[model samples]
Target: MAAYVIAYDVGTTGIKTCLIEVSGTIKLIASATEHYELHVLENGGVEQDPEDWWHAMSVTTKRVLERSGLPASSIQGISFCAQMQGLVLVDRHGVPVRRAMSYMDHRARLELKEGIANGIQIAGANVFKLLKSLAITGAVASSVKDPVWKYKWVERNEPAIFSKVYKWLDVKEYLICQCTGEFVMTQDSAFAALLYDTRKGKECFSESVCTMYGVDMTHLPRIVRSTDMVGRLTANAAAYLHLQEGTPVFGGGGDVSLIGVGAGAVEPGSTHIYSGTSGWVSTVVSRQLVDASAMIAAIVGANAGTYNYFAELETAGKCLEWVKDHLALDEINIYLEKKHVSEAYESPYESLYDYMMDAIKNVPAGSNGVIFTPWLHGNRSPFEDANARGMFFNIGLDTGKTEMIHAVLEGICYHLRWHLEAQEKKVNTSRVIRFVGGGALAPLTCQILSDILGREVETVENPHNVGAVGAAIVAAVGLGWLGKVDDAKQLIQASARYMPNMANKAVHDRNFKVFKALYKNNKKDFLLLNAGR
Candidate 1:
């Protein structure tokens, strides 16, 4: 009876599918989520099986469609937004070569260091190479997470696997190829390669830049705009998704840009903070920018002729998950004892956050002088360092478990403030920021971020689904359901705002000073400090 679009978001931890109806007012009909595993190696290698992502997409789509009770033909289009910077290599037959290298993977740090050692030209490239790259792409990351670096790593480390590669693709491109048999990537996804000619204001893979990254240009996929029709649904994919054959599919982009739109950050300089498995502070802008010193960059946005300035802190909501997995289990027994339920066997994993929050909610803002550093796998934003380790500093005899847990929460906000400092230089992020992500669901986190930023942090009714909503909005615009790029912002209504609590300002101010000093003072030869590091 009404028109609908299926928006699927493939995030670091999971795949979330949303069936959204656009009949005068945009409304979510049904939603489903499926999580996969991240294979973390001791040597800083991080990967995920592509097949697992496909399987999750298959199941989640079918389930969401079933719950919506809409006919397959009624769904007008399907679009996607996926985690950025991941490498998903496929062969001539479109089969994944091996486990995909996640954005979190830093196995190519050796390559990054070698490039930096060459000179101050590009910091990671020679003067000529740096000028050419900056002229075209605006930003270039020589880190292991760059798709180009992943290719170089494969060529050097796994020659056999590298030889079979037919194309170098990121998560969004791989998923698009999987759906329609179209070996193409959107400009937003192509931005991840740091090999695109962005200065042209036209989307195309740059051969010269690819050569600079030591990657073969022939292995790259074709580029398209985010709103362009990649292709119709293939019969097999449609069947698996329980949707009509030949359903329109738009060329969706990376999560960073899509989330900016979904969070109503379509206006230039409209800022938002995202926290899922990985996190960042981003703002939509009309102009191109690059700051090599601070490691922040502005690439093309999900919408045409716009850009998004993204500064990542690497970890946000992930810190919460880490605490849950490692520390919350012990709190379960404490909860049992406090409640006098005699359920000693109770697993803390089952309400991990609630238990931790119960303790954290009661603790003071300063965590009673306890401090936690969130560099659990190192940091990538405001600065780049791979040898840094997560630390628990300022712990004293009086510090309790609750104080330690509260410090972890505070520690995440502290890093976010540091990220904001860099973002403010390029964009005015001093105003209210839209906080959208899985992390925004936690009231404590919202309040902490607001207090730390000294501004308003707002969340919508469906904070976690904003990425999927943004993808759907892209399709909706292409389908003529929406008039302009900014019109889609109305779909998400901000229902709550967390204002700064001045009561904790003085304490946080003192702690923020120490937070910066902790990183500065602990600067050491990490290789020598921990040989296994």
Candidate 2:
């Protein structure tokens, strides 16, 4: 008797869907995750087949609908969240001409520079700077360069695909078209593409820029807000997915902004730290706070009703995975088995983490004058240098596994602090830090963040799936089941909060000073290392 809303998250790895009641409770659903190979032909090229995403979506949506056992008419609305900056070109018949270059694809770096030299502004424009800088510096050669540059590349190199293309869109927009026969993009997703003017909230396809590059503005999808219902499900799509015709589909925002809503960061000054593959410090802001020098600004969200001001430190949980794979596989397996019998595993592999933490706990506050830079894949926000490399400095003969481990945690904390300080300068709001993602499960890491930030960090249960849940929240609101976004977030409850330890804070302060110096002292060296490469 109760109506339900369906939410789909088209992520970098796969498609995830959730069926939820109007009251924000998740019901039965299904997901289909497909892994695609990244093709790197040379130093700076990455590409993936667009059909992969489409196939994944079609299979996953059908699975969710079947698993729920609810008729298509019972579903009131649908919403989505997806990876940002991917470029997909579809012909006039709405078929893809080439593989969709994902956000991780970086082949267009030279093309990005060419656009910049021709009076095109690339930096401070979304993912362009990060991707291009990575390729130019030889830090990463697999990023997709800038979307604008990729657009140009297709125009010049594959004119047949370029000329026949009717819609050039990100993954989310492409999915919407596949579902409802509509070509539309949400403002937030567009903002991250660096193709939209965040200042004016307008699509900025310069006639001159397009003319010079042989790109037609007509190929771009019409922009809409996150909450806006772009279209209804077509009969063909409905039949394929076992859904009712005319089911309303709402335009969703990028993954990060949607995660903000999922984590309940809906109000100004409210901040959260997400530790997935990477880490970030983000706060909600009311206006566009542009930082020309620091690569900081207000990114548009699902709707113009809110803005997200944030900075990222490229690697967080990713580093831990690297360690697990390379350094402590045997120890991890032993700990996991021991954890199954006793309450010791209640922390879910915390014993192993604690063991690692203990090894480094005694190592002096600054890891005995050692510092680790967490730029393994290149610097992301705050410093947009892609040529940046991770380093361990000031290591002595006395340095051991414990010291290196401690230094890794300390370095990640310091990078997070850098972003938080920058965000504090622009937004003024009173809210505790909510920590989510795999890193939040580790008390040692959470406590370190709390001590460094000098604030209470609360960990939410099921942090991994918050993004999918947030998409469900949007679906609920769009269907008139929820009064507002804030009401929807209430469904999320924190499992525990970590308060700062003053003693640890004092210790971290000295190490943080050293960590800061490491960057200033070695930045030139990092740049020089990439020279002429």
Candidate 3:
């Protein structure tokens, strides 16, 4: 018999809870997820109600516990890995002050530019400040999506909320506080705070940086290690989840860090690719690195004294949703749903995914020469450009919906390959990379990605559940169930492996050339066009 750890993967759109065995080889006993709303404004605003996240966490926690049929006391620890770069301002009593400003929010674009570099300086940071930030934090971003600018946006636009906020917390920190009744942050979350003096032996709020930036360091939470047992579960949290009053609540790293663990990328030189709503390529490195131009950073990993080279694009699986919504696949959808009606679930997204995958199964590569730019929300890695837009270049009179769909899929992989190539500059990117995320369930997508990157892409069972697995493993380590984080690799078992189809190599190679040239040719036009809006 094996004991377990309960963990949560609080993501951008929802919360996932898992009851996982904490023995030598970690394994998921049961898992559940609850989704919430993503409110997007036409003016580039994206927000989510904080209460929804708490509700999801509570609901899923109970569901997972019930489904696992394991006594709550058997669960030795609890932890979380959640979305980063989002602000969740809370009052002294752990209540949210306002809707969280998501990483996709662009309402602070002007504020970020004005405060940082107005896009004229290196990587959008003021030239002098850039050097200092790079030296201290090893990272800097002038994007509106950055939490620093989001904080300034609130202070400038919503002064009342700022006045009442007791502390600014990330999603995981807020979740932990809600469960443990202790307001604290993990080291990985603190590093995301641009004001932190990360280069120091003790990572803390930098007084000099705060003074220069006019940020109140008092608003930041105290930092704690991921393996630290912050506090026992509070009575309120315990009652809501039907768990014991004194369940150990441990601190775990953020979602990406935990995902690295879930993907078995804990060792330095291991690379992993993740593609969900957003896509990123991360490689664990021995030291800190910064490529301001590419918006790449070697930030803290899940463990102490380790770093991960990270870069990402704004869109990946999102493009599929865009296609599903915009295309008139009525005939195909009806046919596929009828074909697989017995296999269909209540989730419309799942049904639609099946329809789209079945419809595009035979579509040849290169999308029949239609190249799509998956910069629907702008580019983030390999280059930073808000003005960038998605396009289906080389569309011909014969272009059909299926070819266009394939192009969209191919486009996302191409952009990821671009990010991967850029990441290769700083890290020894492995020829075989571990791929994990919700999108990994799609064999076609994985095959396309492998073909594009010329790398063997492998996915473990329940790719989307990897984040929860990572969180649970972190908790297990904190509980003495595991000796070290890397040892948790015993939990991982590869479900699928994708290899490049050499016969279509020429087609992808030619299209890749066109893909690289598309952005450069439209860079000026992208800015000029976006400026008007």
- Model 1 residue 475 lDDT? 90
Candidate 3 lDDT, tens digit per residue, 1-533? 57788888888778888888866566788999899999987777788998888889779988988898887777778888888888889999989888888878777777776778744477668887777777767776556678888888889999998899999898888878888878898888877877767775758777777665668888888888888898898898988877888999988888778899988878888888898878888988889988888888887877767888888878888888888767734545443443445334324546667668877889898988999999998777788776789999998999988888889989988888887888877678888889999778898889988888877889988888788888887777788777888885666867789898876766898999999999999999998888533
The Cα local distance difference test for each model comes to 0.81, 0.68, 0.82
lDDT of 1 by residue, 169-220 (tens): 8887887887899899888888877888886545687877776667788888
Question: Which candidate's lDDT is highest?
Answer: 3
RMSD of each: 2.9, 5.9, 2.7
Pairs with backbone N, CA or C atoms under 3 Å apart (clashes), candidate 3: none
If both were scored by lDDT, which would come out higher, candidate 2 or candidate 3? 3
lDDT of 1 at 496: 98
For all candidates, what are the clash counts? 0, 7, 0
* Error at 241, model 3, angstroms: 2.3
Whole-model alpha-carbon lDDT for candidate 3: 0.82
Per-residue lDDT over 404-443 for candidate 2, one digit per residue giving the tens place of the 0 to 100 score = 7777877888888888877767676345898886678777
Residue pairs clashing, model 1: none
